[model samples]
Target: MLTTRIRNVDTDAQADAGMQSLNEPDFKALVDSHPKAIMLTAQDGSIAYVNDQFERVTGYRQEEIVGHNPSILSSGMHSREFYIDMWQSLERDKRWEGLIWNRRKNGETYPQWLNIYPVEHEGGAFYTGVFMDVGELTANDERLAALAYYDPLTELPNRTLFQEFLKARACQREPADRCFAVLFIDLDFFKSVNDLHGHDYGDRVLKQAAVCIQGVLRKGDLVARLSGDEFAAIVELQEPSEINAVCERMASAFRKPVSVDFREYFLSASVGAALYPRHAESASDLLLKADRAMYAAKTAGRACYRVYSAEESEQGQHQQMLSEALVASLKVAPEEFSVMYQPQYDLRSGAMVGMEALMRWRHPELGAVSPGEFVPLAEQRGLIHELTEQLVRCITRDLTRHDFGTHGNMRLAINISARQIADDRLEVLLEPFFTRLQLAGWCPELEITETHLMNLSPRCLDKLRDFGKRGVMVAIDDFGTGYSSLAYLHALPVHVLKIDRQFVQRLGPDSRDSRIVSAILGIADALELEVVAEGIETEAQKAKLQELNCHRGQGFLMARPTPLESLVRQATSG
Candidate 1:
């Protein structure tokens, strides 16, 4: 009845008179003054009544719009299927709410947040639509999108957006016609810039570097900041030579000194290029090839570019094969992996004070795979966590079966990878072993590389400290090989420092390494921490370490890494 009355009052004068009659006067006033625009349509889909806000928002007077279909405001931006879905929802649920684009009387398109509800009356069913222009909200959404898809410091597309664009661009063309190159660019000696000048100056250099890189790329190309001191570009090319030309231009761009605070600093870039469809079929594979090529360039010495070559491709293929084989071995043949323990000795007393657990893999086809070779590979393939868990299980089982704690106050040290230390699951996995060792009066030690220790977050350091409180010792393995900062040496919750083999093997009278080792021992003594010299191969090296008061050492001279069963057998024989 209300719809019929409103529809009949089409003239402006009649509409004004009929508005109060169509509904309560207070209700009509409230609807008219409401902030949101409102429209009422008859069951036949013709506009019946519109509130004052609706006329102002749509730029159409009530009399002019009455009796017209709501489609008169359509922006034609939505497909037919979109409208079909909207109507289907309205019919099924009696209400619909969504964002829509509509045109005003002046032909200006604007986005609106709209809500529609069905009303039943004596005359027929009416539909009421309430909406508001959301142009400002849309602008805010765009700002949020930019934040998500860009690196704030350099204002370049981040890794997420770069990968998205790479995938999208690949999809837009046929596989055979996917002619492009991905260039992985790493700034050489950029860490020294941050180390020498602080992060503020480093940030300014990165921003300038971004501008310089973009200057070398074509208008249609995309360059993104992949991470700190690293950038990647998607380059369109007509031929393979064009990729080389682009890389040379990028290298040349960095030859110019970066200026900060009237000071000049020279920085060069190592660029690696891999072509699409030629190097790899997928974007991820292409990016990996580019990264590998970039590392090769860095190895060749900085400030140069290297195209992905057949040699690199062959190496990549070998790595791929190894990765696949490793995955299969992990899933189907975990028994191929076992734990070996090497005794750590007290050089002064000639007593075995500790044993370090080492991981050994014997593949059926590959024979003995060196931990040096496969361990880093496992880390890169994200299989390190799984491997570490398996090793933990094997070590715990061996310790329990052999009753290793019965061998006097022997401490057990397990090498923990950075990945494992950062993984929360690792704490859960090692908790039971910690409890067992605590009950047995044996101090269990976790050996983290000095490099990883320095890079660890405060949270990870806190975790190590918590372990210390629980009587678990934290030892820094391969000390002096990484940052070796005295700052962390004082700050980290460490119990022992294992001198790296590199420094230990060169120990001699008046040699630089011997002095370095002496300095390390002095620092450890001043800090009241224990020291273990690694890789002692000869009587002279062991004697030199003892002369330096290193006290504890582990090497082939004392004992090589052997399976727990073999070590137990040797003890039984003795």
Candidate 2:
């Protein structure tokens, strides 16, 4: 029996009245009859009665729980404001349906969905709370192989999952409701955690991060892990001001350091957010814009957030389409992808020396894409080798029409990369060009950049050596970019050091530039390799090369890079 007090709720009554039931209806028994925990509390929040379900959930007997303040069940999960607000609602009208968490007698805690209502009589008012175990909700959530589309650690949706979620969510929105927002969260420098402590530890850091994030969430908000080091959330708001409040709270919650493995670690996230219906009508549009906004946050430096704008997203989509088109262009007929030869000339004699076969693509949609643009893109997309193969075939074909054979025998140089040097089948790939064009001694020079030389493996070095033995001339395209590259000149199978344009730009009055150019020439002279001063646009820069005994150069001073046919005409005319 619960002690009953009909009078206004008092401190002494609140403290002791729970010991004796005032013949109050056996509501606790009703709760026990059903299978979930139930409790009856007086107007002041002291437990007056508890059902057997409550005892089982909290590991306390009815007696142990009775007469105690309901605070015994508090697991420090809810804020002081949470309890204050719940009671305030009871004092006013009463009836709150939501979830709360509490600790068991043994100290383990779990969540419960609660329905609290005011029990009023002619005598006084009381609160009755009925709670069901939500353990199963999360249980089934975890056991179900959680759609492969989600990032498991954060329970955040992956990109594929996000796209599907966005699509479904977008269709649900009405034209009038344009208030929902999508946020993309990226863990800044998260790779360093994996590199320094191993991925296992990195996974823990990420999971811990998720728990901290959950602390800031309001009801009806959905947060999903987008991918490794990236998280996404959908904030459903009825008003625009709510967006700022939600984002600010979420960003600030990351202020305290994360505790992992008995150590404190600091981590920050960059958040890119976009409003639904406002920024995009389609799923891909929403995601693409959010991604750009995230990149903006990252670019601005970490621990920041940016909202997506329509214009930014459109520009990003345009770039994606362009990049996609550039990739598709490469698969067309070989004739669509052509080479433009830039003629290198002998400075003293003013006669054309050799030609550098530069790549050009007359893409169907995007016409006349340059090598500088597509080459970097291809390298990233790992299409450089295929592009190079196409180049070899083109150069081999163009050699037949070259009138440069009249000017003391000139060769065409084609650029290659570290990727080409590592391939054992590279020589095999070149055999077609060599055999088809009858690769005579030094018929084509293979050009490589400073980066290619620095990254070369021993197998790659051996491959370059093999090319040298096969009468393939190798030239280091840019000389002074990487450290000790000049030192590696002889060890490399290179026959030419194309002085990077940096030295030539300063040649007019700077003796420092002149000396640097002179030093490079002396090194090349000692190594018995040729030196070509690149980007010699001024006649003064060109005549200075003659003074330094540098024999060859290429730049606008000779002529802007011309097509192979024009290159043949110019070299032959000279």
Quote each prediction's TM-score: 0.57, 0.57
lDDT of 2 by residue, 1-574 (tens): 1122233565655434443443446743455687667877776656767787777777889778866777777766454555666666655775765556667889887656667876654344567777755543332364236334446566554565456446545655244744788777777757657876899999999999887666777666667776787777777888655766766666666667779989776788777777777777666777767788876665555577778866655655555565677667667667777777778888779777777888878876678776766786676455777888788777767766663455454766888877666655667787667555434434667888976687777778888887778666788887877665556666887888889998898896567989988988899888998888889889899888999999789998887877667766754666
Off by over 4 Å in 1: 1-216, 222-272, 275-306
Error of 2 at 378 (Å): 1.7
lDDT tens digits by residue: candidate 1, 1-574: 0111223424555444433344667657877988789987765567877899898888999889987888889876555655666777877998887667788999987656678887654334567899876543322345535335567787777787677567545443443544889999999878768876899999999988998999999877888999999999999887767888898898888888987778888899989999887887577988888988886676566688888987965676666677788888888898998998999989999988888989988889988888987787787566887887778878878877885436765788988787566678889988888888767766799999988788877888889999999889889999898886677679999998899999999999889999999998989998999999999999999889989888789999989998888877877777
| Candidate 2 wrong stretches, greater than 4 Å | 1-142, 146-287, 293-318, 400-409, 423-427, 435-442, 485-490, 570-574
At residue 266, candidate 2 shows an lDDT of 76
Per-residue lDDT value at 54 in model 2? 76
